[model samples]
Target: MKSKLFDYVERDNLVFHLSGVTKLICFICLTFSVMFSYDIRVILSVMILSLIFFKVSGLEWKQIKLMVIYVIVFLLINFVLTFIFSPQYGVEIYGTKHEIYRFNSRYTITLEQLLYQITKLTKYASVVPLGLIFLLTTNPSELAASMNRIGLNYKAAYALSLTLRYFPDLIRNYQDISLAQQSRGLDLSKKEKLGVRIKNIMNICVPLIFSTLDRIELISNAMDLRGFGKHKKRTWYASKRLKRQDYIAILIAVFVLVGSICISVFINRSRFYNPFI
Candidate 1:
């Protein structure tokens, strides 16, 4: 199951033509651009462009359904909370008040606040696609390789890689253990009521934690035996030689960064706030 999950992300055919660093740089640039401005139009544009890039990367919709759901939930929660707490937030941005409902003393619903919340939602939506792109396209080993290329110690890089590599394994192990327990007369299904489900999950967590600890101890022992931290420069199996594509990718990344900075200045004359607001 673990191998299958790793294989899903580390598709040999898909990864062959792309550099991990290129993906990383693009992700960072797009994320920064999303963060730098609060203009809804710019945010929407970035979001659409990110979706196009994801499609071009050959990511399957089925694999990303959970991510899409998460983004929806995130946006919904943010909008709900913002509206409840700050119904007049638009007055701050647009200097207008179109009231919908007046509460006792300090609370009121207004058009400006709703639009402000919508604008903030757009900002979040803009960056979420880029975050998903990074997660879906970057294999653990490739991510570690990218980190190593950027001057991080190989041991630290490998540790981060292993953490990501083992996440799906840990999730699978939990699912398998839950199923085994269910087969042995434990009811963990949602039909068991929320309280019962919580209790059963807690019951499952004890053994899961124990197993995880045991695995960690075993890995530590093996690494110690192999003198993992004895030398300064450890070798990496996933390292790729920088090629013409990599150079081109880096050049493009630099161009994007510089261009973004210039555009940011032209649009706002500063890095912090959107002048259009």
Candidate 2:
């Protein structure tokens, strides 16, 4: 049977033509843009741009549906909880509040808090696409090569690559184990209480842990037999030499960094939004 867990996200798409460093630089730009602003307009703009890139990357809609669902659920839960518990959170951002509802002297809902929550949600949404882009577009081997080019040790780079490579394997293993247990009389799918489900998952975890350890030992032995890591510098079959694309990638990163710094200074000095208040 095909393993679902280690199923590498492969695509013969345009994104693959961009060197790993280029994708990495783009990721850093998007991340900084998300984190460096509390402005909802900026965040939303970044998000929209990221979505355009996602389309350009040629990722299947069906493959990303689960991630989309998770993001929506996370945003909903975050905003709901923040509003319920800290509706006065807008005091930090707006320096004032417009009361929406007053339950008591200590409990109230305000426009400021609601807007603050929305801004926070927008920030998260901005970063989510970039995170997904990095994960979906970069292959494990290429990512390792990028890391190595950036002066990381081969061992460390390869370990990082292996971790990414094995994630799908681990997920597939868990699913197979769960299925086997279910076929043998486990009822994990039942709508039991949350606590019961937790207990059942724990039960599954024990065997999964042992199985993973055995697999690890087998892999280690095989590597040792093949003289893995014996050399001071191991050659990589998949590693690529840095080219013109990599230089352009680094140049882009420098431009983004400089631009963000300049914009931040301008905003702080001019206080452009001060006139609105």
Candidate 3:
């Protein structure tokens, strides 16, 4: 099958071989570690590790290029807004200011602020790969199975699984509808002005939404006929027993989480690492 955005690929690698439960556990631990700490060292290390794992998983750059571009644009906007709103936030946290450039008293750029923003950017960047890995390496049915194994309600788990699986279908439907509209002389191409293109795109939404609602109703009726969610428990075809590698992966994730907390709480004595001090 052709891989759609965030679609799982079957492979012989260790990451692919691991149970979905293990991937979920590790993803949670690593993301929490990044979110809870402001240390650049910790964040960069996680980001680098995530990149290595992403490469090892055999995913091509083209698969995530659009997503990465969007994230970078968002982070750039966030960095600009952070400095605009709270130019002295880093100085307030670090208790020192080494001014780099003075736009004015209120808008001066400082080393501390730059470092803080870089750290924040890295913190967010670290999670992107981990999220993509989880989404792209784990099968939707297996993810639902893992969630249910972790004590989530089976109905919720199944719903979540269906939601994940729906994305490719959504993309396909959008393409089909867009082609139909384009064939009807609704130009979404570069020949149209930017505003015109956007307005034309909005026209596709009405049919897309109606089609999506029709799909939902069809699935709901099918589920009702099949007596889905009538039982308190259900078995998963994709479920697997955790293996030795799964245990090791979970252990490494736990160690990373513990190490992040220990460094922030014990060594740094704060989440923010102050080089100025």
Candidate 4:
């Protein structure tokens, strides 16, 4: 069977070959660099790097298309809601207003608002590629080992690994359940109204939930039988020593993060880049 979306893809590439600990650190640094900086330049730089990483990881577009669409839809809704709730938020931040369009006394679009919103959108959209690359390349077992290496409790790290592994399984299970239901005469096709389609899809949840619960029970029982967590320490089959490339990657991520913050403080002079000035 084909690998499900978000499933780890084994590839002999730089991104894939990096230590999971390195990837986790790079992800945090790069993601935070984007998240903490309001400067469009910094956001776009990280975004471009993320895209380059994604390309190097050999991840196909098909693997991430559904998730990209979902993120875009969610971002659009969030932007619309932000605009409706705080039309002059940008003006307040920049201390200047260049009206682009006036919808009403309360709802007016300005160059500041547009730029602000665009920056916010880009900031968020930038993280997706990096996150996808990390998720699609890192093995959960390795990630758990990495987490434990970083001083996290082995049990918590193992639980997180299980959670990461569970997500792909859950998605696969949901797809299987959905297909079976559709084969049994449920109409989830586009011909159904949106409401009807959603209603039909929700019907799969009951079985999915029950199956998931059963899976949890089985896992817990197996772990108990194996005496999991009975030891103060456990060896990891996937543990790997950090390589030179891992150090380089982590340092590059740290540099990017520090560079972004430095630019914000010394050059931009504030978190919010004021282009109107």
Query: What TM-score does structure 1 among the candidates reach?
Result: 0.83
- For each candidate, give its TM-score against the true structure: 0.83, 0.83, 0.97, 0.94
Q: Give the TM-score ranking, best first.
A: 3, 4, 1, 2
TM-score of 2: 0.83
Residue lDDT tens for model 3, 1-277:
2336766669889889989999999999999999999999999988998998898899877667768889999999999999989999988989999999999889989999999999998998899999999988999999999999999998999999999899878877888988889899999889889999999999999899999999999999999999998889998999989999999999999999999999999999999999998
Residue 266's lDDT in candidate 3: 100
Show where candidate 4 strays beyond 4 Å. 1-3, 192-199
In model 3, what is the error at residue 174, expressed in angstroms? 0.5
lDDT of 3: 0.91
Q: Return the clash pairs for model 2, or none.
A: 5-168, 6-168, 6-169
Model 2 clash tally? 3
TM-score, cand. 4: 0.94
lDDT-best of 2 and 4: 4
Model 4 lDDT at residue 178:
87
Q: What's the distance in Å from true for residue 145, model 4?
A: 0.3
